[model samples]
Target: MTAPRQRTLFGLLPWPERQAVAEALRTETIGGIVLVGAAAVALIWSNTPWSEAYEQIRDFHFGIPALGLDLSVGHWTADGLLAVFFLVAGIELKRELVVGELRTPATAALPVIAAFCGMAVPAALYAVTAAAGGGSLDGWAVPMATDIAFALAVLAVISTHLPAALRAFLLTLAVVDDLGAILIIAVFFTSDLNLWALGGAFAGLVVFYGLQRFRVRGWWWYVPLGITIWALMYNSGIHATVAGVAMGLILRTTPDKGEGVSPGGRVSHLVHPFSAGVAVPLFALFAAGVSISGPALAEVFTSPEPLGVVIGLVAGKILGIFLGTYLAARFTKAELNPDLAWADVLGLSVLAGIGFTVALLIGELAFPGTEAGEHVKAAVLIASLTAAVLAAVLLRRRNTIYRRLYEEETLDADADGIPDIYQRTLAVGANN
Candidate 1:
């Protein structure tokens, strides 16, 4: 008997996982649309007669004096609300690392390599551009992120007939990309070293993990602890979002005996809607209000830092991801899924260039409160929009081709009463 076939990279997901991913994608698609709308409103309002009001609202500060939390509206969204978003991200990442695509070396290699190269190339390109133009290289990491929500939204808009594996690949790539972005923020963006607060935050995380290890259950137990950890983390001089991710990672992803879902999965399900629909969109509403005038638009191209951001997102991401995938398949045991073509990979690479959310966060950190910050934000917006339009054009054509193929496949399956694809899959399983 022939041995069971080894799964190729980006191969089909199992049914249950596939269903979960599909549901998550649908939710994210809606969130992406809402985020885009919020961004548009921010841009229009920022440029209108009430521009000052927009700025005033974003810059206004109020806080809990007891908690040492005095922050502007924009900071609250970025540091506070965005923590909820990161917590959800952390849960997703933990799931992938534990039981999803990243659980094994063979399945994880391609996307992980692609994600690293994707980040490195953009940072390198940004460094080259910024240094050549005598600009600071502080914003080198801004374009390293792929906003999954925006990318998914673009795919939904295009009505792509791309394989499910392709979407799974994007999701895995984005998860790794997020982890990289988080590390960069923690290492590069932090200023004051409040060791006391940091230690306190770490202790809270330990207790959080202990609770998970003991299988201690209850929202009451977690909610207050989560808040205290977040507050301490904020005071610790590291980004508060790091606390959110820490708590998420500490949560158990595998369900206890007789449980329907893992704690991490349950929390992710409950929190994901709020994270995507409210936290993320609200963050975008505050972050994407950069000036887009004739001169400001010109500055995105002329200014060294902002220009680097544009190049990094539009050009660097494409080259990084495509080349990384190709080289891995060429040299390693990893193989691209047979259902996808190089052209499909190219389109997905372009789609990865829609670096909106974390890109804006990095830009804010890199240029904090400077005129350069605004220009860099504008560059991000411009580059992301350009990437989205280009990806739409390419994917739409590919989608048409795939639609035809799918129609033919469906017709053949109807005649045979069983699809050839499924027949082959069953045969392989039977052989095993």
Candidate 2:
């Protein structure tokens, strides 16, 4: 008797999980357009004749004196509103860890290794470039992120008949990337830690966890507790966004008996729109407004820090992700899905370089309130655009091939009175 064929990495997702992933990609597609549009507007407005007006608005400050929360408009968007974006990311990460792609070692190993290598190679590239130029190494983490929204949007624009497994692989890789970015923010970006406030934040997290454990309901309770934890975390001198992710991870991903959706799912659904549509775009509106003159553009390439960022995002990401995936498949029991070609993986790896949201955040944290920071932001835009264009060219070619294959398959299915793809999916599901 012949041995049964083993399931491959990036194999077909379960029907329900495939649907959920598709729904998320749809939402992120729209959000990504908005985000790019917002960044474009900021870039235009900042470089126009009325640039001073833009600065005046961004630098405008207000706050609650009692809370010690005075901040500029830019700071509010970056430090406050961006937390909501991270909250949604954290919830997604929790879901993946608890019951989705990352739940099993066999399923998770490929993406996990790929993500770590993706992060490591970029950081190493940045460090080497900066060191060669005698530049500061603080911005090492800036290129380690893959903006899922921007990446999915790019895929949606360039692809029509790409394998669903490729999309799933990208999603899982980006989720792991987000987790690494969150940890970098929490550990590397913090300053002047406050023990008392940190203790308070921990206590608030405990309460939040207890409520979930006891099956507490109502947004009212969570809203206040979440705010308190975020505030305490901010005062604790850790990045305040850590609080948002902490609360998100604390929420239960699995539904209770008789409940249709899990609390984490419901909360993510409710908050994701605001996070994507408003919070992230608003953050981009403020954060992306940098000088883009001829001299400023020259500085991005001449300056070691920004140059490192560009290299890290555009080149290091591709080498790291593709090599990692190849190594995993070659050495481990993991196998690439037969539906996907190595060329498809290469395209997806290039797509992974479109870092934006968390990349900009890290640029600011790395070189806070300085000219270098602005230059790094400009570099991120330049590198991301470059990567997007390259990935688009590659994926569009693969998409055409897949479209042709799809048409041929459909024709064959018509002759047989059933779809070959559906049969394959059913067979895979039964085997698994």
Error of 1 at 375 (Å): 0.4
Q: Which stretches of candidate 2 lie over 4 Å from their true place?
A: 1-26, 421-432
Q: Give residue 324's lDDT in candidate 1 (0 to 100).
A: 98
TM-score per model over all chains? 0.91, 0.91
**Candidate 2: tens digits of C-alpha lDDT, residues 252-312:** 8999889999999998888886787789999999999999999999999999999999999
RMSD of each: 11.0, 11.3
lDDT of 1 by residue, 1-432 (tens): 999978778988888886675466347677898899999999999999999999999999999888889999999999999999899989889999999999999999999999998999999999999999999999999999999999988887786566777788899999999999999999999989899999999999999999998899999999999989999999989999999888888888999789999999899877876787789989999999989999999999998999999999999999999999999999999877766677878898999999999999999999999999999999999999999999999888878776666676677786657667754333322422
